[model samples]
Target: MSHRQYAVTHTDIEKLNARLLSISLSRDERDWQSVFHTHHFTELFFVVSGEGNFLFREKLYHIKTGDLVIIPPYMEHTEQSIPDTPLEYYVIGVDGISFQPAGEQTCVQVFCNVSNKALVEEIFSQMLYEMRNPAYGSDKICQDLLEILILRIIRSQHVIPVPIASTYMTKECARIKEYLDSNYSEPITLDTLTDLTHMNKYYMAHSFAKYTGKSPIQYLNDRRMQAACTLLRDTDHSISAISASVGFSSQSYFTQAFRKKYGMTPIRYRQSQAGDDAANGS
Candidate 1:
């Protein structure tokens, strides 16, 4: 894979949509061959297991488990499996993205030996599941994930790594934030945080607010509300379901908190977003 980097603008991302033409989960265990072919739209080719070679425009590239190959539109390519090992892979084709090749002429680009193959696989799995079931805003969800996949491919190249906060969190606050980030979908309480971190409630709350500019419970609720917004905009799940899924004790309480924060009911917020989607032809 060449370091053929290209700039992605906000417009490019805004043009994104997940109206996939087709997606396939295939396992090629034995030797298999395919004639050179091209696609009308872009593709994300992920190798889940086995070994193989991908022939892009007659240049052979060694491929195996954990390889992610991006094939731009009309990029002639074919694949074959190793004699004993098959190529288990997913093929996702999508429309409405703009790509420009980086320096040097290259037939294909690859993100190999990916560290987050499972995450990639899970995103694709969820997308395919949603596609088959046709949930509300499912295409948007998948498209958003496709954008993530693109970002992952760029990240695997080691150009630069995103930075995390270097500011110290008084041990307890950091622990609480980590817990809330992972378990915000589950019940949380001051007692839970205090017991888990072995800190007094008053101290924990004070430290968390000091470091993060919000109380521990407020931060947890913020996370839950963020997740709820996504669900409400993307899924047809009832407001009550969204409430419980994000760890709200009750639908009524969830509504109250949501309105207090966003200044509108959950249903109203969702409907507003839906109208925006329709207006934008999304």
Candidate 2:
């Protein structure tokens, strides 16, 4: 379903909370920091114009057109427009993150090294395209591509220390979040996370919960539901098919979970979107 079609009960449009999606135009002469706030979603800012620095997690990082700044869940961050140009970008907040253990670990790093700016540009370009000519599943595909770009940011960044936590585990946490983001389709257990972090399972889970507010399993399930919602709205796929696709083992269980979180059955939600689309003459 189109993200706009979701019956969002609590969307923070200034920084789209929960389901990572936003687009904004910037005035050419404005610059400042946003009111600092924590979100329950991960954010991606793809600058469309101007230059700036994002103050995130007590570290200042530079930004510009085509640059991406990722603010993970519960991380306090904001934008600072550069001297000459005002900052603008298509911003999106996805529901969860995954960690990839193999990459050069970075904690709150900005990605300026572009071996492939063209690829990053193309991803944002496609976002513009989808917004203009939305097809079946286009929103879902755009969000997936956004996920890829954020993953690239996590993998290709250089580490900079933030004051919230001591130890290299901060970097380790970033890697684990990236890993979880990439591997969300698979089963994630304490053993899986422990092996990835090279720490004790109980200790690692506690630390993750301490920093990220949700246990690893809770994070994964939330991501799965985010994916499931997109699928149910976009594809003709059955509820059972989507449940399995997002790693839920049972249709009934998925339905129960979906209703609890979104306040409607999957089928009913899809039908509602269909009704709205028809009413809008789309």
Q: Model 2: per-residue lDDT, tens digit, 159-224?
A: 332322221236566667667766887877878888888987787877776666578888778778
Model 1 lDDT, full chain set: 0.74
**Predicted structure with the largest lDDT when compared to the true one:** 1
- lDDT tens digits, residues 1-282, model 1? 678878976533333333466778898745455776756566778887899899864268999887877766545578898878888889998655423334422223444567877898898788788878887898778777777876666556532211112223556676687788779998789999999999989988987876556798888898898889889999999998999999999999999999999999999999999999999999
Model 1 misplaced regions, further than 4 Å: 1-19, 29-33, 98-108, 158-282
How many pairs of residues collide in model 2?
16
132: Cα error in model 2, Å: 35
TM-scores of all models? 0.46, 0.46
Clashes (backbone N, CA, C under 3 Å), per candidate, total 2, 16
The root-mean-square deviation over C-alpha atoms between each candidate and the true structure, in angstroms, is 19.4, 19.9
